[model samples]
Target: MTGSTTRLFAARLAGTSVFDPQGDQVGRVRDVVGMIRARGPVRVIGLVVEVPGRRRVFVPMTRVTSIDTGQVITTGLVNMRRFEQRGTETLLLAELLDRTVELADGSGPATIEDLGLDAVRSRDWQLTRLFVRRGTAPRGLAGRLRRRGDTLTIDVDAVVGGVLGLASPDADQGATNLLAAFEELKPTDLAEVIHELTPKRRREVAAALDDERLADVLEELPEDDQIEILSALEGGRAAHVLEEMQPDDAADLISELPAEQAERLMALMDPEEAEPVRRLLAYDDYTAGGLMTTDPVVLAPDATVAEALAHVRRSELNVPLATAVYVCRPPLETPTGRYLGTAHLQRLLREPPQTALGQLLDNDIDPLAPDETLQAVTRQLAAYNLVSLPVVDEDGHLLGAVTADDVLDHLLPEDWRDADEDDDLEGTSGKEAAGA
Candidate 1:
C-alpha cells in the first residue's frame, strides 16, 4: 500500500496514510497546509494529520521523506500537539479547493479543482501547479451535457488574486466557488467551516450567503463569530438576517450588542418582525419567556384539523414547533386570547380533517407561567414527557412554548457552541476532518 511517487495532487493527498520510516502507520493526511502569497509559488508548510484518538497534528514537510502511492513516509519525529492553524496558514483543501481564481492575461475566471506540490530542494516543497475548470459550474442537464469550459493544469503563478492573494485583504474574493463546494452542508456544519476561515474571508462568505441561510448559520456559530459576521454586514441586511433568525435566538444575540447598536439594528428591521424579538429581549435570559420562541404553532380553538395540519406541515416549521398545535379563544398569534389547551400531532392525525382543534384539546397538563423559572420549566417538560410546554400570562393570554431543545441549550455550558463535536473517527480515508 506504499511506494515512492513524485507526481501528486493536493486533492489526492487527502486521507492518504502517513507512515513512519519503519512503515509504522502514524496517521492519515486530512489537509495540506501552505502559505499562499500574491505572486509566487505557495510554500508547502506541512500536512495536517489525524493521529489516533481523533487528534489532528502537524507534520512538517521536512518530516516527509516520500510522497508515495497510497501512503506518505515520514521522518518519525512529528509534533503530537493538536494542530492549531496560525492566521497566516491556508488549508489547501478547506480554503482553496474550488476557490475562484483569475486566469492570466484576462482569460477569465477559473475554479481550482486541485493543486500539485513539488519538492524544490532538500526537504522543501512548494505548490507550483493548479488544475482548474473554467467558468461557473454547469447547472441543468443541457448545461451539463453542452460543452463546458476547459479543464487544464497551469503554473500557480498563472493564477492571480482572489482567495490565494493574501496580500490584498480587501480584494473582492467572491464566494461562488466556496458556496458551491459547501452547498450541501447543514447550517451547523457550514458554521464549522466558516469558523476556520480568516476574518476577511468570513466576511466575504457571509456577504454572499442569502439572509435566511446566513441567519441559520449564525444561530449555530459561536457568539463571537455571530457578532463578527453580523457586524460586517450593512445595517439593513444585518437587520434582515436578524428577522430570519428565530425570535428567541435573535433576541439573545441582540442582547449582547451595545445598546445603541442594538437599537439601530432593531430600528432597521420591519416593525412586525422586530416586535416578537423585542418582546423576547425584555425577558430574563434564563426564564421561560426568554427561552421560548414567540412564533410557535398557535390557532383559534375553532380552527379545523386540516387547517392546523397545513400549518404543521409547512417546511419552515421546526420539529418542536410542529409537534403540537395550541388552541386559544380568539386571537391566534402569540400573546393571543385565553389559553385553552394543546393538541399533539398524534391526536391531530387521527382526528377527522373537519374536526375542530378545540374538540381534541389536551387539558391534562397546566400551562407554564411566563415568568416561570428554568428549573420549573425543565420539571414540567420532564414530568409530562413533552417536547414543548405552553407559556401563558396570569391574564390567561397564550404567550409561547418552551421546547426541550431550548432548555438543553441553556443548561449546557456557555462554551458548548464553540466546542467541536466528538464525531467517531472509526473509518479512515474519508473527507477531511472538521477543524483540520
Candidate 2:
C-alpha cells in the first residue's frame, strides 16, 4: 500500500496531518498508542487522531497502510469512538514526554525529554532510540550526552551496552516506572521543568501529578503559565486542582480569566472551596479583597495558645498564613467571622500554653476593609513591617489575609515572574533546557 516508508521520531509524528488515499483530510496525530507486554516487544497499537468537532478518535494500526514523514495513511475504516486508554495501552505522548527513567547502568534516572522511533526490520514501527539528558556527568553515554547533549541521538542499545534490542527490559522506557523518579523531585523542581514546556507538553506532565502536588506546582509557576495549564484541563479537573490550592491563589487565577470562563470553572469547584473565591472575585482587582487569601489561620476567641500553635503545625498551612492566627468570634467562615484581632507567633511563644488566645490579640495592627485599595494595603503592610495583613468587611467580619507575595505581584514589573532559569539542581540542565 506504500511506495516507500521511513522511520521517524515519535515526537515528529505528533501534529502531522493524517489523510485518506483520496486526499480527504481525516485528522492529525495527537499521540502514538502502543500495547505494552510483560516479556515481549511493546508493539505499536494505534494512533490517537484529533478530529475536528469530535476531538479525538482511535485508528488502530491495522487500519493504517503506511506511515511516513508528516503523514499516516489508512487502509480500512477507522473507529469513531473516542480513545480511552486501556490497561495494556501506553500513550506515548502522555506517558513518555518529560519523563525520567532509570538508566540501564545503576547510575541514576535520566530524563527522556525526546524519543526516537524507527521501523523494526524496516517495516514495523518501534521506539528505537532515547535522546536522554542526565543531570550529572554522562556515564555510559560516553560523553555523547555531555558532548552533543544538545543535538546527538543514540540508539537505546548503545546506552544499554548493546542489549538485545528495544524489546528488552534494559532500555530507556516510558511512564510505567516513573513514580519513583518523580517522588524524589520536589514540586518546585518539577514546576521548573513544566515551565519550560509548551502548554501542550506541560499539560501532559501536569496531568500526571496528584491534585495537591499539582496545586503546589501551579503556585510556583507564573500567572500566565498557571492560566495556560489550567485552561488546558477540563473544567472538573481544573476545579479539583483549584480546590487544593490556597483560596487566594485560586481567586487570583480566576480573576485573570474572562468572567464567564472563570465563573464556569468556579461552579465546578466544591461549594465550600468556592465560597471564599466567589467573595474575592466580587471585589475590585486592585483592592485588598482581591489579594487576600481566605485560607488564613483563624482561631475562636476562646481557644488557647496550644490550640493556636497546633493549628499552625497542620499540614495545609502555607508559611505566610502560619505566621499569625486571627482570633475571631462565632461564624468563623469567610464573610461572617467578627474581626477580633490577630495573635502573633512571638506572642504565642511567650504566653502560657493554656492562655486564652483572646488575651494575646494584638490591637495595634488594624484589619483592612475589603474595599481598601492596593496602595492602602501596601502602606499598612510597610507601616507595620508585616508580611501578611487581614481583610475585614463593613460589618467588621474577618474575610481573609493578604501576604507580601501577593502585593509584590502587582508592584513588580509585569514580566517579573517571567524570568527563565532551568533549575537549581546540583547538576541542573538549565531550567528551560530540560522541559524543551
Residue by residue across 1-436, what tens digits does model 1's lDDT show? 1245655788778668888766678877777899876656688999988665555677888778888778888777765556789977888776776566778759887767777778777568888888888875432122223435899998876866532542334345456445654566668767866876788778877877888899999988888898998988889899999999999999999999999999999999999999999999889998999999988899988899999999999998889889999898877787889988999999999989999988999999999887899999999999889999899999988889999998998999877754543454332322232222
- Tell me the alpha-carbon RMSD of every candidate: 7.1, 18.0
- What is the alpha-carbon lDDT for the whole of candidate 1? 0.79
TM-score of 2: 0.59
Residue pairs in candidate 1 whose N, alpha carbon or C atoms collide under 3 angstroms: none
List runs of model 1 lying over 4 Å from the truth: 1-83, 86-89, 97-128, 131-153, 159-170, 420-436
* Candidate 2 per-residue C-alpha lDDT over 1-436 given as tens digits, one digit per residue, 9 for 90 to 100: 3554656667666667777655566777767887655454556777887555433567776667778666787643545555566766776655664454455666555555556765564346676677666533222213222322343455665444332332233222323223223344456655654554446556655655667888989987888889888997778989999999988778888888888889899889999889878887788878998888887888898999999999998877767778999888877777656889999998899989999998998989878988889999999999998989888888888888999988988888766644423333222111111121
RMSD of 2: 18.0
Model 2 steric clash pairs: 421-431, 422-430, 422-431, 422-432, 423-431
- Least well predicted 10-residue stretch by lDDT in candidate 1: 427-436
lDDT of 2 at 318: 69
Rate residue 314 of model 2 by lDDT.
85
Q: Over the full model, what C-alpha lDDT does candidate 2 score relative to the true structure? A: 0.69
